[model samples]
Target: MQTRTALSLVAIAALTACASQPMRAPFSQADLPAAVQVPAGHTVVMETAAAGDITYQCRAKKDMAGQFEWVFVGPDAGLKDRSGKVIGKYYGPPATWENNDGSKVTATQLAVAPNGAANIPLQLVKANPAMGMGAMQGVSYIQRVATVSGIAPASTCAKANEGANQLVRYTADYIFYKAM
Candidate 1:
């Protein structure tokens, strides 16, 4: 019908208008204060502390890279309850720096111990994202951790393997550094 065709055209137009665009820093170099310096790198090397299944830490450029780019490093832990064993293991945030550009990074890497790493692209970071509000006092905010399942295992299984094989929760911990 003519009505259907017209409606479809309108929808297409709207969608096209929303096409992705390049990111530009809201403020230029001059806009930033004199004291501000580009970050070096940030990473969270695995340390003590366990939540949900991941042990994570965050670091920034000053202590890492030479230039001002942010990087987050950590580990995610996965398990198979029934087997009392770990199905897979890794630690990295899909969105790192604890975040980016007033938010978090778009890429997440799920690294399996002894070698394997599962990379979640920046697009997904653009997809399932965090919401922010300034001066939101007394607000209860929450978020969900997206999973990168079934990573291929390495030839050598560590003590992490030994279980009855059961349903379990896997977790990735991100350690965010304040500087980056």
Candidate 2:
């Protein structure tokens, strides 16, 4: 009977220690490009994986008459937690991140660094004041990394296809940070 009680105590102590450990961040900023790294004085508050499409349209290149290329229109993605549960969405012309609770933030691009020729660039954005009072309440910065295949279509973008829209699927991890 005494042995059983001692074993129970040990098990409880182990569980307590585990519960006190801090949650590990999903990704390390050191592995990311400097231009896309979150600034100091901020701590990660949320991390989500975004999976969706980027819309691009064929348009005449500015100041380069007779030349046409694909221009980024915007993104439409579902933001999911590590377990793949749908939590929010990211979309826009104005570049918005919205939680299911109706809280949202619009942000301006701060910097971008190349990921690869076949992938879209990794980016950093400064979030504007959030609109509601949920998960985005104090978000200061958002980093878009781990990008996969959001590049423009490889097809010809001649004048014949002007205004044609193409959707390129992509997956990326968006890490949200707040002032510490």
Q: Rate the local accuracy (lDDT) of all candidates.
A: 0.30, 0.94
**Clashes per prediction?**
29, 0
Q: How do the residues 1-180 of candidate 1 rate in per-residue lDDT, one tens digit apiece?
A: 999999999999988876754543332223222232223342222111122333222222355443232122333443222223332223355432221113322333322222125522111111223234221111111112233432323222223432212222333222222222
- TM-score of model 1 vs. true structure: 0.18
lDDT at position 34, candidate 2: 83
Worst 10 residues of 2 by lDDT: 24-33
lDDT of 1: 0.30
Q: Model 2: what TM-score?
A: 0.86
Per-residue lDDT tens digits for candidate 2, residues 29-77, read 9988788888889998898999999999999999998999999999999
Off by over 4 Å in 2: 1-26
